[model samples]
Target chain A: MYSYSDFDEAFVRSRVAQFTDQVARRLDGSLSEDEFRPLRLMNGLYLQLHAYMLRVAIPYGTLSPRQMRQLAFIADTWDKGYGHFTTRQNIQFNWPKLPDAPAILGALADVEMHAIQTSGNTVRNVTADHFAGATADEIDDPRPYAELLRQWSTDHPEFQFLPRKFKIAITGSPVTAP
Target chain B: MTKAHDIGLRMVRNAGGEPGFEVIVGGGLGRTPMIGTTVRDFLPVADLLPYVEAVLSVYNTLGRRDNKYKARIKITVHETGKAEISRMIEDRFAELRPLFGGGDQAVLADIRTAFAPPAFRDAPVAAHDAFYRADPVFRSWADTNLAAHRNAQYAIVTISLKAHGQTPGDATSDQMRIIADLAERYGHSDLRISHEQNVILPHVHKSDLPVLHAALVKAGLGTANVGLLSDIIACPGMDYCALATARSIPVAQELATHFEALKLEHDIGPLKIKISGCINACGHHHVGHIGILGLDRAGVENYQITLGGDGTETAVIGEKTGPGFAYDEIVPAIERILRAYLALRTDPGETFLQAYRRVGLGPFKTALYGEIGQKDAA
Candidate 1:
């Protein structure tokens, strides 16, 4: 439901282009695997057992129909015909090729989505009660603040690197309610 | 916070028109699983940030750094004890309290303003009832997927991602689109991703349930198995996760298919079977009613069972059920446990948990290993 501003769009597009160049460099032997590892991880790319896995963020688990259709298109075009929705509310493409990573990210950017902070030591996606606005017992919806937290934490200088990966979850419901 | 060090903090607005939080410290699951201890019954909401700072500071400074496994805050709490941690946090809170001049209230007010619920409309319930009566499939789906909403004309619908025999917590791109469309048209544009790996349409009008269900059915997303055995929670084990020692998805798929074919899922009532690839408990096997933890025993996939674990308000870690079973033997082992439960239960009204609690694990163990014991004796 949250649309990206021009700045946000520019930021993501630039990152995609940057990663595409990096992938090319890695393929051409200009950058070693060790050099490219952290860069790829920051973009939510992982070398899993069988193939490269790409995790795309579904911010606070909210998506419009347009975004959903775009994701469907990505699944059909790039990876397998389906995507695995993770426990964290993100989607994982298990069979992505290294060369297609940039294209996948560019497609995500078209829908105001990204894989940034879905991996690496920085704060992962900020999760909240999926029933934030709809629950009967909740004092308030927690997503607006979750969105605020997301904006604040995304690429924040202070938390760029940490001793461990951090996760934050918000729920407006009382302890006994859920 | 429950997994890491720091604390599992729960905040609620009290009758006195102020928010307060209950702090639980030291709870974690892995090799050394422990439920958090309640260190503070309640702390003023205003002091939350400062208190959290204090807790994190303690963990950051003193938590284990040498061994990656032992670095979580839970281990630190285990080493130092809750009382000592509480004292340290309280002392730090006192020092930090003066810095916060009640600015949190304004920020909280702004946040509350942003989260206001949408305007609800009065809708005729007769339309929903008529649809329910006309379509048996719709009726069954409504019975399982729908929950009571605050508004009389509204219902909360849970879109179960765990379709029978499919990978748990996976939604196809088309399924996702259908859910999105339903949310926009009927659910006030609100969708929720449950921790149990399901999509939720939080505020749908009762009048719209029929059309929504029809759309979901068309998309292959309508699975009337919420909280059923088929609605299993499983992690991507050996098939996907590099850290996995055994396959969790295939085991879940097999069990789901097996149970569905037997048609015993609905009769069994609400049962949570969580499967983890390993001891990390990513599938939350520690808290499942029937917890299955996969392990590699001598190059063979072995699944160990844990009974009586619950993740609700009355949380309890599951107890192990002797030696682990091989990959093929796991499903039959589960069937044996369920059969024993069906035989032992007082009535259909008694759930698996109730029966398990009433009779304890002795009979279930007998059901699982009884024939093997007799065979060995012979």
Candidate 2:
């Protein structure tokens, strides 16, 4: 797994700080639910059918063991004792509280992961075939390219207001008959 | 990759043997399912960023904004027509290509270094062979959950989250930690989550698989049902998603439990059962060999079945069978179809899709709808 560069670390920390403020404002009744909706969603928070769901991005479906342990920690401490991994290679904590959102983001930052661009009509998680770098059939590791795209698209200013969520997938290997 | 993604890139070596992409644009699944069109037959690796930028730019400028349902790039491609879309993308790519200035390549080069293949150890696999010969349970899990690795000494183990009757993709905190531990100890600290909603230990030494399997079994992560009937793809339907009209998780659980009770999942062979709560297709039901769409028809949970949908390199949309089944009736309906397939297939080797493609939907339709075709003829 690629370790986060200093710039990457700083960027996530800055976003977490910003979101902490946003969440506090929303909880204190200053920002209306309507007002706070997009703010929450921009950070991958969703007010679901029963409770709040926080989706954390696992860029290109790659996770270091340290990161996985952190996710497990978040699942155990904050939300329910489980997490649902989505089709896009992201994980969703189905029962997060609005007040605890920033704290959860902080824990994720400790492991160099975040929920940025995971929701709200932005360029979403850039996914690739799970077998990248490990499969013999691969012509090249697509993770590097997927990582490049993930960096380019994360919090991309222009893409935040797109008509719908945009998705991009890359596969380094040819598909065989399933 | 499934052709249902918004942009699907298949890596291919051109005739001259240089690596590049066969870029397919505008494929999506929701209310509408489309297999993406191949806009560029062969896009050089150097052009990937710029070309993708061009496609996005074209979409941003021209894609429908009036209707939420039609706002996807798939609809944009459909409305614009492929040739015009291709031409527009090409024109945009030509204009945007130079702006990149190869900076992306430098970053990619650096990223590539991080992903270098792990050091595989040459260890004796005598124990692995012995276990394979001795333990039937270990052998079944090994055959079902493991994939051949680039290094012969290594095997890619798919840790099945689809333990019988469990929510398809939910991993308990304890299971997550167990998987993390396995990855760190035996899997070179590499873990992958498949789109099919399973965790993968991508590089486990074959010699270490038995121990890993025992740990996984202890954690209740060992069902040995990867790519089997019980290995379903189900979305968080009405249970979680506000947009859902019906529940998907319970249906998946019931189906898995039903098939497991029959003790027939392994014999049923590689059957994909994808269930979506609504038309959003989050579960990728359209691609399942046995696709089930749960709909709230007049306040009742009605399930619709689609047969022969495939999500491979040769992707095809599934065909819907006759009338929908009630929530309670769906499982039995499915059993009938599978039983019909078992009886109709020429051999056990013939998969559900192969049998469907060869014999067509008539037999399965009759099985599900109870010989309605003959009744209508009569």
Candidate 3:
């Protein structure tokens, strides 16, 4: 599991504070849903049919036990005691309040995780073969390349308006483009 | 996604399951998606990055980005035509190919180790029957979902996400942690996501089935319906998908519910039902034995069915079966088709795809919607 550097830590905390402010305004009705939709989505918050669904990005589906425990905590506190891991390697809580998402994001930031770019037609969590690190049939660890892509695609201006949500699944060098 | 073998190159399969050092390129997903025509079969390791650049340059220039629906590697290959793309790739390949031309030896020079499958003990077949022994629940699930691995002592495992009436591919945070631990303990700490949106422990020792099953059961990943009718592939639809005209997740749930109610999933023997929010086909509707693509009719969600599609080593895009059905009528429509497959299939050995190929879609369509025509041609 990769630990967050100092820079990664600050970046996440900043993003959390930013989202926390946004959530406060939205809950206070100072900000409209129309304006907040993308913001919330970027933060992996969704107003689903039954309740709010908060999707937490796992960043290429990699997680340490500590991070996993934090997720369990979120599921217990803000959700229905469970979370859904989506096809994109992200987790979704079927229940959460509109006002609680920022706190969830804040918790995720503490774990060096965030929901940024998990949604909204941007280069999604740079998916890779789940067998990247330990697969008997891979080149180098695909995570580094996936990480490279994460940096490259983060708030990537050029790909902002891709025709569709572009999902790039890199693999062990060139051997398996899983 | 590039596959080295498809490009006319060849290499020895490693003692482990992987092929010798090389690269494959040009695969993508979506409506016009392709499995990517393999550009180079087996090239040396060093040529990887440069060759990838060549392929991307071609795709970047030629791939259709205009039509949101058609902008995928498959569409590009289809429109540009494989022959031309091969030539362009070959031409570009010559200059860039050498970078990776150095082969497996180069990998030794680097810190990364070569990839290979482990040696298996090739144990005498355990009365696999012992696995099923008598627990009908586990029996049915293991029969439907478990896949045999090449290693006599190992099996490829699919952890199904379908829970009947629930979102198909959704995994809870707890589920993730449990599965991760399972991978670390039972599997090789390696997991792969199947195109069907299921998680796969690609290498599970056969002896560990019971222990693995118990852990998975606790985690809710032990549904044991890997290739069965209940194991469906569906895209997030109108609920969250902005590109969707109709909802797919709900429709998938309804069908799964219906199938569960009937208790026909495992007994149905290897049937795949893929549903997509729209023709963008994220759920891989094109590959389902009974494919359902959601349609919006008068602001209401309807579904169009397709037959004979498969996603595998032998892949075929599905064909439409006449008109679409309203939301209420869709599940029953699926039931009608499944019945047709059941009544028509030769035996349990004949899967839905095989049966479809043998008898074709006409009989099934006629059984559901009345005969406009009848022919066995797939």
Candidate 4:
């Protein structure tokens, strides 16, 4: 699994802080629903049917045991007891409170995880075959490149405001590559 | 290769040893489902980036901006046709090719070196066989969850997230931890999340199967229903998704529970029942053997069934059955179709898809609407 460097950690921390301020502003009536909607979406927060849903990106669907444990903690402590893993290999906390979004982002930042780019029109999470490194028939692991792409696309200026969401999926195995 | 248009690009490897890709374009799924057309049948591996850049540029210029629904590359491809799209991509590629030169190959080489596969150890098969014989449940799970690995001693284990009566792709925090632990200890620290919403331990020694299965069982993740009806793929429908017109999870849960109670899934053979909350096809309902699309008809939730959709190498979009069913009528409707399949199939060897293909929709439709038709006639 890829671990966050000092730069990566600092980037996420700063973003989390920014989001925390934005969230506070929204609560304080400084930002309306329309203004806060895109901001919150870029942070992977959605005001769904019943409650706020927080989608956390699991890049290339790879997770360390420690990271998985942290997610479990987040699920147990903040949201419901379980999380819904989406088709994109991301996990969604269906019942998150509006106020807890910052806290959840902070918890994720501790584990080198974030909800950034999980939603929005920008290049979303770079997905790879869940069997990337482990599969026998694959030409290569594909995750390293997926990670590279993730870093390159995270906040790429040129693609930040594309008309639609861009999804990139990579797979080494010909049999499983969709 | 066919559905490339939907996602903008598809790379099919060239047959020769020299690494290359045959890029397909314009495949996508949604209200206007389309399979991608082959734009470049034999693009060299080195030209991947510049070529892709060309395609995206073409799409950026030509793709629809007026209607949000029609903005995908597929629609552009549909309007312009494959010939013009190909010509535009080739022209762009020609212009951009010189900028790349040969730098991308070195980068690719470095990436390949970093992605080398892990060393695997041979394990005795006797241990696995012994465990399989000792525990019937383990045997059942092994039969379904395990896939043949390149190494004789290794097996690819699919830890199903779709347990009976549960959300199709949901895992409890405890289950996730157990899977992580198993991947670390038994699976050479390798874990994968399958596109089908299952956790995969891609390199587990056969000798470690027993302990892994036991651990999974303890964590409530031991569902031996891979490829079975219970192993459904359902998107978060009305419960969570704003675009959804109907609920998918409850329907899946009910069907899974009903099948489990009957204990008929394993006997029924391989069946893929994918449920999408709407036409967005996030659940891949279009490619499921039995595809269920939830729609809003008036104020009520209506479920539409599509039969014979296959998402394999030979992908086929499922054809819709007649009218949609109400929320409560869906399970019984599914039951009727399954029963019809069971009765109409040539033998047990014939899967749901094979049976459906052979018998067509005639018998199944009759099974579903026969009572209603009779009542109306009376």
Candidate 5:
């Protein structure tokens, strides 16, 4: 439900443009595999087992209908015809190619989404109870806080180079007896 | 169920009736599973960002950087002890709190407005009632897949991605569009992806149930196994992940297909079968009712089973059964455990988890290895 502001849009589009150049450099051999690895990871591209995998963040597990449709389009047009949703509330395109990474990110930016910090050593996607706003047992929706954390953690200079990936989760509901 | 994250925050009300959090820290699964420790009894909602920052800063500085496996905040908490870590976090929080300058609070206020609840329709529930009465199939699907919404006239629908024998969490592009369409048409355009790897239409009016059910049935997304055995949570494992030791997808597929063929999942009731390809525990195998961890035993794929693990608010790490089964042997091992459960449970009302908790692991262990070992010896 949260639409991206101009600042958010500009930030994502710039990241897309920067990654596009980084990808081109890698392909042209100006950037070696070692040099390109961290650059690609910062943008949520990973060299998976069979092919390159791109993890797209679904912040707090929330998606707009338009965003969902765009993800469907990406799945059909780019990699394989499907995407795998992980336990961390993100989606993975398993067979994306190196050349298509930039375009994939660009498509994501159009929907006000990105793969930034999805796979990095820095703070990853902030997750919350999927039934945050709708469930009967909720104290308050935690997604706003999760979104705030997402904003704070994304490219935060101090946490950009943590020892390993960090995960944060919030729940608005206390456990209820079945 | 936020118990298995590096930082897990549960919304709570303090004595003054102000919204705050029960802040938990250092919880994770992987090879060494740990339930988080409550670092703060109740932290004010306004101080959340600063407190969290303090925790992370403490961990980032003191957390082991030398060993990748031991670098998590859980390991840090284990080595540093809870009291010391708590003291350091409090000290850091004292410093960080002033620096925030209410900037995070200002941003949070703006973010909160974006999460306004969808306009719910107060429609008659005649269609849903009639369908439930007339169609047993719809009734079954509705019973399993639907959760109670805050608005009584609405329901939260979890569309099963784990249709029998298919890849558990993989949704085809068409499936995505179908869900997207349903969300737009009937669910107020809000969609959620559950940690259990299912798509959720969080606010579907009861009047729209029949039409939504019809669409899902036509799309093959209408499997009525939400918390059932076939609704497995499996990691990518060796099939897609570079870190996996053995294939997880095939094992999950086999188990789902196997139980579906037996036609006993509904009867068995509420069993979580989570599989991880390696000790990394990405599948959250440590907290499953039946946890299967796949490993490379002398270059051969071997599967180890852990019993009675729970991932609920009362989280508990699972206990391993003796020895590992080979890839071909894993499915039958699961079959043995379930069959034994069927014979041993007091009544059908007893779910797999309740039964396991009641009888403990003795019966299931006997079923899995004892008879097979005797037969092999003979």
Candidate 6:
């Protein structure tokens, strides 16, 4: 599993600070639903049928035991006692409160995980085979390339405002690709 | 090979202990989902990264951005044709190849030198049998849900999500935590997501099956069903998709309710009913044994059913059973089709698909819409 560097850590910390202020503004009527919608969406918060859903990225679906334990904690503490594993190799909390979401995002950042690019019309999470390194027929695990895409796509200036959400799934071979 | 004193790569096996790398691009599900075009039939290990770069650049320059529905790589290949796409990719690939591929054969040799399957202690042959004797649910799940491993001592386990009438492809976050823990403890920390929207632990030793089953059940990720009728793939229809003409999830829920009510899934053998909101085939209705596509009839949501579709090594698009059925009448329509398959089947051994393919979709059409005016035809 990849650990976050100091720069990555600082980036997430600032994001949390920004979102916290944003949430407070929304509550006090400074930010309307229209104003708060894109801000929250950029952070991977979705307003689903039942409640607000938070999609936390599990990059390439790889998690350390400690990170796994933190996910269990989130499920137990904030939302329902479970998380849905998406086809994109990410996880979603179906019933997150609007206010607790920043705290939830904070908890994930503590473990080097975040909800960045999990939603929005921008490039979404870059997915790879869950069994990348351990697979029988891979020429090489595609995660390194997937990671490269994740870095390149994040807040990309030109491709950021495309007409639709962009998704990229990288697999080393055709037979096991999808 | 960066030889580690006790470190090693686990589980890489094919004939002659090697399989060449291949690549596909632009495969996705949505309104226009299609199997990705084969971009690389064989990529030598030395050129892996650069080839992928070339593929992405081609897509970045040429992929559509005007229509949200047509923005996927599949649509790019569809519009330009695979040959043209490949030609452009080749030109880009040539420019990038020399930069990455030159004198990298040693790295290639180093990579292959380290990969191998895990070695496990032989457990008693009767272990699974002993567990089966104690738990019937475990027995049924293991029988249908597990895939045969090339290494006889291990099995690929599937944690089914298709509990009768629940949302498919969904696992609560706690389920994710537990599954990750289970993978580390029992499955060598490797997880897999099956095409059918379920998770897999790829390398479970036979001895650990009993404990793993218990933990899975506790977390509510355990269901004995694998390929039975209840394990459906449904597209998110009018609920979220702007393109859908009808609802797929509710229809899937109803079918699941009907089959589970009858408790006839096992007796009927394996059946897959994939539901799509439109002809784009996101739910993969075209490749299902019994496929349902939600459409519109006079501005009202309706369903178009197809039979004998398959998505295995022998993939085929299904033929339609009839014109279409009203939203309220679709569930009963499917029931009629299943009953017809049961009656027309020559043996219990024949699956619904086998019978449908053998007798053709005409019989199913008659059973489903024999009462409709103008005589519904397959």
Candidate 1 wrong stretches, greater than 4 Å: A1-21, A148-152, A156-160, A175-178, B1-7, B15-17, B46-50, B90-114, B371-378
lDDT of 4 by residue, B1-378 (tens): 234233433334566665445465666667877766768766665676677667766777777778888877777888998888889989989998898777665655555564556688864789788888989999999899988776888888999998898898888888877777887898777666667788888888898899888888888888999889998989899988888988999999999999999999998989999999898988888888999999998889999999998775566788877788999999999999999888878889999999887888777778877966634423
Encode model 2's per-residue lDDT on B157-271: one tens digit a residue: 8999899989999999999999999999999999998888889889999899999999999999988999999899999999999999899999999999999999999998989
Overall lDDT per candidate, in order of appearance: 0.79, 0.89, 0.67, 0.80, 0.90, 0.71
How do the residues B176-226 of candidate 5 rate in per-residue lDDT, one tens digit apiece? 999999999998999999999999999999989988999999999999999
Candidate 6 achieves a global lDDT of 0.71
Q: What are the TM-scores, per candidate, against the unseen true structure?
A: 0.90, 0.98, 0.73, 0.92, 0.97, 0.79
Model 5, position B268: C-alpha lDDT score: 89
Q: Give the distance in Å from residue A162's predicted Cα in candidate 4 to where it truly belongs.
A: 2.0
- What's the lDDT for residue B78 in model 2? 95
lDDT of 6 by residue, B148-192 (tens): 654567777888877777777776656767888898899876666
Q: Which candidate number would show the highest DockQ if scored against the true structure?
A: 2
Model 5: pairs clashing at backbone N, Cα or C within 3 Å = none
TM-score of chain B of 4: 0.94
Interface RMSD of each: 3.0, 1.2, 6.8, 3.0, 1.4, 9.1
In TM-score terms, candidate 2 sits at: 0.98
Task: Write the candidate numbers in order of decreasing lDDT.
Answer: 5, 2, 4, 1, 6, 3
Candidate 2: give the clashing pairs: none
**Candidate 5 off by > 4 Å:** A176-178, B371-378
Model 1 Cα lDDT, one tens digit per residue, B1-378: 222223555556767867666666666666677777777777775566666556656666677768877866667777899889888878877887787576655555555565567788886899788988999989988888887787878989998888887999887777767777787899887777776788888889899999888888788789899888888888889998898999999999999999989989989988989999998877878888899999998899999999998765467888887888999999999999999999989999899988999998888888888957634423
After superposition, the stretches of candidate 3 with alpha carbons farther than 4 Å from their true spots are A1-67, A93-102, A109-112, A120-122, A126-165, A170-178, B1-37, B41-43, B53-136, B148-156, B172-195, B199-208, B215-221, B239-243, B372-378
TM-score value, chain A, candidate 2: 0.97
Q: Model 6 residue A143 lDDT?
A: 58
DockQ of each: 0.43, 0.79, 0.18, 0.47, 0.79, 0.27
